[model samples]
Target: MTEKKNAAAIRGPSDHTIRDQIVAAAMEYFSHYGFEKTTVSDLARSIGFSKAYIYKFFGSKQEIGEVICASCLADITERLNAALEKSPSATEKIRQLFQTLAVAGCELFFRERRLYDIAAASSREHWPAAVQYEAALRERVLAILLEGRTAGEFERKTPLDETAMAVYLVLRPLADPLQLQISLDTAGEDANQLAALVLRSLTP
Candidate 1:
């Protein structure tokens, strides 16, 4: 984690690295100050670059903000996928998902609260990526839930899509206007509560 943090908070990028350090500095600043309040000059100065350099990389503050959100979400989806894969049971899988979200919040918020805030505010702009990520996550969850149902681990009459949507609804606030950042412990419990509620509704 320390290495990853160091990698992100750095001077410049390697020829092979996909990320740009100038953008990293800008994102860090924006996360702290917010998109509306942050300026190109501030981001440029922070990274020791001219404002022209910043504009060369990102046309506007909004573009920089959106790109940062995309980068964060891409990283987050990887963590979420790992969490779902490692859990021992469907109930635990749900817990893992929330815990992953909490960890993501820490990484994003500790690094840049404003990035998460800005992303939350302009979700529609990134809706296509968001939808793709959600579909992939939901499919994994649905498969596990179906297995649990078959094993009598969970009870449910709700369609898989509906159940998955319910789970998304519970956690969606983590990303948006509600912008609720939670501890890992709280996120885990919230996941458990949501899973339990869904299961109880399905109980015969």
Candidate 2:
């Protein structure tokens, strides 16, 4: 069978319901067990489904982890956007972005350490979800830079793309799952200090 056809067959006719059920069960299982230690078979048994049945929805344990990881990242993005919306200026928005992301990362690390493990694995493995999340974050930073420049609040001599990339890199330690775990103790202070430095650089 073609790859598309194989995927469809594996998903079967009740694709959405079955897929959601599998993902929900996997989230609960991974929360207690962590991602690396649990296998698809273990999740299948926990949910009262056969291994073959679980396979109908997900190809492997990592696939389930990806779904949960994507969900976690999406939640962080939502909170970041909400915080940004409340800011009156581009400078405040940029600061809000860093603070919100740092706070979110710390919350995940301390409260949901197992889910944080899944995120770390996703980053370490270069999963598509992690890659997309990074891309989305970069775009947000670029957009903020453009807004600041257009408003004459930021210097326009430097290339916006380069500035965006630099800003993203500075924020990566607080945003990237693997790095965030290592930086938790100092992430909040680092985020505030970095935001101040970035804002200074941008001043026209």
Candidate 3:
């Protein structure tokens, strides 16, 4: 028992490495068991370290959930940016953005139901990281709209910023996890049709 406890107490080579491991392990547990079910001691045991070690990196389990939520959104944003880079037209880019977000949101949020719980908790906790990610999302949508206007792919009857905001709001449901799930479950609306409708609304 003494040897076992000592073995669990061993730290990783460095703080960064240890922190990454903790986050990675937490992600697995959170995905499989859920944020509410996973505990600090559980995480520590999984990483072969003490709860104190996890504390050295994260203040609490909620912090780990926040990081996971933020990381998931960051990944989605990267995919959206990549879609923009590869597509030929602003219209195509807009379509790609919706498709990308729809798939990514479903995979990330729906793949693990617990992630949705974490997201909800983060919202209630007022985690600024999630809020910042959403703000960045709005900005990216605005950028895509401005690009479309410049290329004459889309018309802007409203002010540029207003139009962008409106577009974001209108299309947001398709990307929202709960809304996306509901739409898929009840309406059987795939991402392709959804993307097309959004693109059609902006057609010149």
Ten-residue region with minimum lDDT total, candidate 2: 1-10
Best by lDDT: 2
Error of 1 at 140 (Å): 3.7
Q: How do the candidates rank by TM-score, highest first? A: 2, 3, 1
* Per-model lDDT: 0.62, 0.85, 0.71
Candidate 2 lDDT tens digits, 4-66: 122323444477887888888888888899889999889889989999988767777777777
Angstrom error at residue 15, model 1: 7.9
How far does residue 17 in candidate 1 sit from its true spot (Å)?
A: 7.2
Q: How close is candidate 3 to the true structure, as a TM-score?
A: 0.78
TM-scores, all models, native as reference? 0.67, 0.92, 0.78
RMSD of 3: 7.7
lDDT of 1 at 12: 38
Ranking of candidates on lDDT, top first: 2, 3, 1
**lDDT per residue (tens digit) for residues 1-204 in model 3:** 011111123334456667668878888887778888888999899879899867766777877776677766667778888888999988888778777877777776557778877765665565765566656668878888889888888887868788778777766766555466566553224656756776787777
Candidate 2 lDDT (Cα, 0 to 1): 0.85
